[model samples]
Target: RGMNAYERLTSYWPSYDSISPEARRAYLQWLSSGRKAPHANIGYVFLFFYGLERRVFVDAKTDQAAAGDIPIIIAEVERLLSIYGKNNSFNNYASRFVDFLRQGQILARRYQKAPPAPLPYGYEMPVELRIGLGQLAADKQPMPADWALAWVLSDHNVGKRTPVTRCKEAFAQLFCMRYEERYGAGMVLPQNKTRLRLQYNTASAGLPPQELDGLSGIPDVTATSAARKKLQQLVDECTVQLEPYSRYLGRNPDTPDALEGLLQLPVNLWPPTARTALAELKQRIGDGMVVMSFGELAGRLQSAGSLSREKVLTLARALESLHIGIEPDVLTGSRTPKSEDNVALFATQADDGDLRSSPAYSAASVTLDLACAVAAADGDTSPQEIMLLSQHIDSWSHLSGAHRKRLKAHLRLQLNQPPTLQSLKMKLEPLAEPAKRVVAAFLAHLAQVDGEVSPAEVKLLERVYKTLQLDPQSLYSDLHVASSGSSVGSSQTTPSIPGASPSKPVGGFALDQERIAQLQRETEQVSALLAQVFVDDKPAEPDDVVVEETVEDTSSICGLDADHSAFLRVLVSRTEWSHDELEAVASDMELMLDGALEQINDMAFEHFDMPVTEGEDPFEVNPDIMDKLPL
Candidate 1:
């Protein structure tokens, strides 16, 4: 009555209480007597339970036991298990062990998916990766190392594309965009994607298009008030000269070959002696080779027309710079057909001793010369302008050593090319239509040198525009909006060139103190911004600098020898010193101080050589305190 159902299950004698006295005695007998009765199913279950309960053997104890002994041991375990039944047997142990192993596996998977902590909020991420080893080995010059970093951020595959093709595409896009940014979109005449693809294909094949009308345009680089004023002046001057020339030519009605008056003007002016010298040189060197010589070339032009030696020399320099095959010889024989044809485009002679004009000229040289003249007129040259000029010069068709030398000399002298048809046409080209406008705008400022554009200067401008493969009028817009302070082909808002002074005029104009100060502030801000972008901005050290200094001991000390100090100095100087010049010097002093401290320690410690008794130890407390104390 006192024990409930739970208590009955917990109690050990539940069977003895419920069953008959005989059954209870039998259960007690079964527990006390361990007997082996071999039945196949019982024996199998008992042996399986025994094997399941076996501990992992560390030694060879189980291997030597008899086979019959194993069955007997299993039977004895089963007899004990029969009393306990299924509840307290091998099943409980197996279930608990399985549960523990399964729980561990679950934990291993859960920890694997957790995200790492984000970097601190203020830290800047590095933008560039190290260039590949292959690229470094193959590189001939120090390529702009920063270019790769800038490139990756602005133009790389975000997801699907490969890095190489993406880089190339990005670069192409940037090149075109840069042009549009500096010049107007109209300047390039960019069409639809299909048209651009076709154009790109044609360019790739080296097959240039037939003559098209260029979009007349000015660049954002010329957005300043000074630049506008200069451009207006150029337009006015060119209009004055060209308007008259176009009228005159329209009235004359002369055939291309039969301009009798024109022929006589140049022929009568030729110097026979120089012409003869040129003819001899041309014969000896062949027209191809003689065309490269400036002296011979100048004489050839004199033979063609009434050019002064100086004017002839100027033309010769321009022509040779273009790499055209022409000689001043009057003789017609031995001139190969190819040479004859090439010279015909640059020819100024009809039959003999006559000025015959051709359609071609050195457009690039003339344009550069005009720009240089404008820059010189500015009074103070800027680094931006100088860099642009350098880039412009680099784009020209490569010339020979002698020709380049002469051309540079001419530029240095600030000499103008004459206003002949050939010289004028040489100032223009189809591919560089926007460049022509740049040159023309600059030419306006050039007249500022003397205060006005002359008839000769106007004529030079007209001839240059006329020579371009594309029609120049198409590119230079007729819209002259004086109030808007802009023209048709120019951008409404002009962007300044990088590293250029935005406040200063793009055209050659003087700035006041206020403007100069503004430019300085802007430049400083830009420098700071650039510093933030760069990873390593340290100034390079001089290659031949002494990074370390040796300090000699010239002091008298207690028992320290001169040789020991000298040895210490050598040891200090020999250690690697990697720091700025000032810091390195300080570091060397600290190292020398450290050595002196060590020397002092040695003199007090090991060098003193104090004798010690066998039983004595320095750190032990004295046990003779009782002896020292008063009794």
Candidate 2:
């Protein structure tokens, strides 16, 4: 029993003095094996955790190991949690330990010191993640995916008492889509070199002896007085933007006005000198400046004659930090190619942009939507392919830069959002004749770009063909009549799809002269129409409405049985409850505590589409059903 680790454990807390002698031997044996067991006694793990906590908050900080040892500490903590995380006591402490590490990173940033490390995506809760990623202040417009991601990761009630978490996989899909689109093309990326910080108060704090409970390796409440989250005014202002995306913590979300609510604006913390710029930017945003082309942005910033180029860029960054995205791409130039215009610099500010107001733009935007549908038709194309598809959209420079912005946004939304027949129906039904032919030919071209037409592509194309009244049978021979009619190199839009590197028909169709001519002609017609019809011919009544459907709460909520349902209602009312309180309630309802809990959680996974309710002793409800409750 007198071993190295047992002695270390006692140094963390005197409570370890009562650990059983048998447990003591197990703990030492576990430590001697490098503490690498996949499973171990919860008590033994806690004893080890006591030492880890000391290393992080006490030893690491006090000994200046916070410089580099924190990463090793985090890795060890994560490894321990991977094994014992199911234990409520262990999971809660470990999860909070990681979160507090994140807090330290944020605090370190504020103190102008280096953060130990960046928290990787999915490493912590969504609330903390959003703040860390600078999403909180990002006056991000509520795109359908954003709303859907928020709704699905949240909790909701199916019936009177049946509460469940919404789909997490859906949230992950949307998150990855957004991340790749913003950061680069891929499922995940390494952390950016942005600064991070966190602080702790030690002067006014009193230290606990080893006899006291094992300290949680967190800073004192005084240091965290503002709760780590209260940084950046704009972040606090647009609370609806990112805060609700908190990762499911087995607890239900706090209730607000489930049925209704009001938005509270963040205070303007910008210094007085740039007040003119802020006012100008606000005015432009209010006046439908949704797609602030680099050209337009330079002119507007220059209107502030007092502000130099550096001052203008600083002002833009300041606005972006507040979540008001404006001209992020254009740095020093007033003139940029139409290709550069597609950046939705003001996407965080405006909901319905004037870009869609133009009949020509709206008519053209639908083309990109269907293109994305075609690209994803097989449901196996990589995001990079879809992005390459955006480059194809980019070649349609005939459409103004503003139009491209809206078009690309549509493509991104379609790629991640749940597909809807109604949106396609609405868009296709209203198209004029020229628009219809161009739309049909565009899909035909995109579908066969891989040389061999996929069944999924053919199937999606058939639907599109029928919708536009293009003859599905004539899909092959109409355009490719003669070899001279090939249009492969005739226009910029014919740039080969990523997989189809060559300009001509690729696979089996590559050698067939008739098929090659057809692909060329198909490319020509599609490009010509895109250049002419998309900009020249405007529909009499263009459907300028953005294609997004409001998903009903009923669609997402998973229902539980009468007993479990009733139990859920009780659980959602409060975040934390003692085991005795939970048991007393279960007994009053004539239900077995363990079975009802398990059954309800099963429904949480099955219907709510997430695994909730991890640990107990102090249950923190995070389901969205609690969203209806006043916070």
Candidate 3:
């Protein structure tokens, strides 16, 4: 009578009777104390967890009333793990027990007809795994980095699906990235398997193995208000542009020649003359090149009657950018086409000068002209300069072959008889404001391409600047860009270019050239910033810049509006920031983080010669930049 059935089990060597009287009393005290948390012994924690496993598995299996306790059991397990999870074995068993309650409980023999508790509280399926199990891409989670994490979670054989067999993890990431691009994120595939094979150390509980449903819906990432606003703007813009052509979209946006595809569908909306030219070009595209000679192209263009040079160039260039070759020299006896010849799209008369109607082409063509002029300033144009000119012409896809040929001829003419620099005011008149800065910036960069701006090249740059109505000092900044490797700043405020500057005054003990002094100032500013970050000492400010953080209005700093100004303030305070840290702050500030860094640096270029922030991942403030208010 002294020992009941429970007492008999407790008296077993591995049970409560195995512990000392003092230890047994401590365990009983903990049990009576409501099992709150911060338990003392791992054995005591496991001893208690064993009973929970039995109640959930054994009792719930045969009794419907017992099955109702599954959720409560899961929550209790979650709570205990929160406290004593430091024990590795206990952590593993407790976590698996909870996983069973949430997903595997449905597999029990008694619960097979219907799971009393389906997906217990606080449990979620991973999006990638759900997708692998056959979730629709449109319905599945939006994972920008799905490839990085998805395939590993899938736990399936994909050897037959891909050519890659090794480094599966890396290949999975690459495959998934491409998968997202082609099919759009995730394709809702049919569940690869309806049943999951969950393996864990549940045998100790004396419970039989059971099957559970593996299919689970993934929770989608909620779109932030800012994201929704951008989506709305894009939808509105697309609606305006596509509404008229929606009916003509015989296929998806994957169609390269949408216009030709539409025109083939028996449409009569196009003008007869426009249709004829389009048909001929389409045939030329099928033939792999535009076979007409320069004179023939001119004849065809003139036959258009009222078509302007701007319209002719724009239409022809747009067609060529699509990889449709317009080889005006194919029939010419030379056989080989001139590479990057800025030839006209439709033929032009000799009197019809350089095509300037297209603003984009005007800016690019002028930049090339100024580049050649600057290269020849020293009266010795090397192959490198000429090569650079040709490379640019090849990359300018928006210019027609005829127009590009013209540009190429201009380069040749310069090499044979170097053209002298002249006022570019009239050439720049039709160009946009941003294009104007490009004209002067390109000249400075070209002069500094050889690593040093010569006196002759410097004078030519100055003249180009005056002609473009830009500041002459910016010439040095542009040269500095080539010397330092920074990008061109915006038109609003001329920051400078990137690249190597001429070697500094070597000794640097006394006053030197203004450019050398500028370099010294930048070096000193970098030192001041280092002192602030590492030594926590305030560096003496330049006399020209005196900032009072407390007195300043955050809404506007260095001509930036409220949003950007605040973003810059955070960057100014820290020297280095991780990509994630910057993204978090940008998201919190409601600013698009993708190009936010560039925009801030572009504006910073105006005030300082250096970029405020640079680098993509581990984005950091330029250590060499001035330690002033970089607004």
Best of the candidates, TM-score: 3
Residue-level lDDT of model 3, residues 557-626, one tens digit each, is 5777655665665554344667876676666556788776778787778877678877878886674453
The TM-score ranking, best first, is 3, 2, 1
RMSD of each: 38.4, 23.4, 30.0
TM-score of 3: 0.28
* Per-candidate clashes, comma-separated: 16, 29, 33
Q: Write the per-residue lDDT of candidate 2 for residues 1-631, one digit (tens) a residue.
A: 3444333333222345676665577687888888866655565776777676667667765677564687787788888777767665456556556555544433311212211232222212222333322222122222233322332232121111111223233223434454345434211211222211221211111233221122223221111112121211222232223233222211334422111100111113222433466566666665233554445554443332233344444444455554454432223232122423433444343433323334445444555566667767787765445645666556555566655654565565456542454466754665566666655655665555544456776677667777677666544432231222443222232222222323443342234445444544444455444444345434342222322322333312255543455456555434455687667656655578788788867776665565445578876555433322211
Query: CA lDDT of 249 in candidate 2?
Result: 17
* Cα deviation of 112, candidate 2, in Å: 33
Relative to the true structure, candidate 2 reaches a TM of: 0.27
Name the top lDDT candidate: 3
Superpose all Cα atoms of candidate 3 onto the true structure and report the RMSD in Å to 1 decimal.
30.0
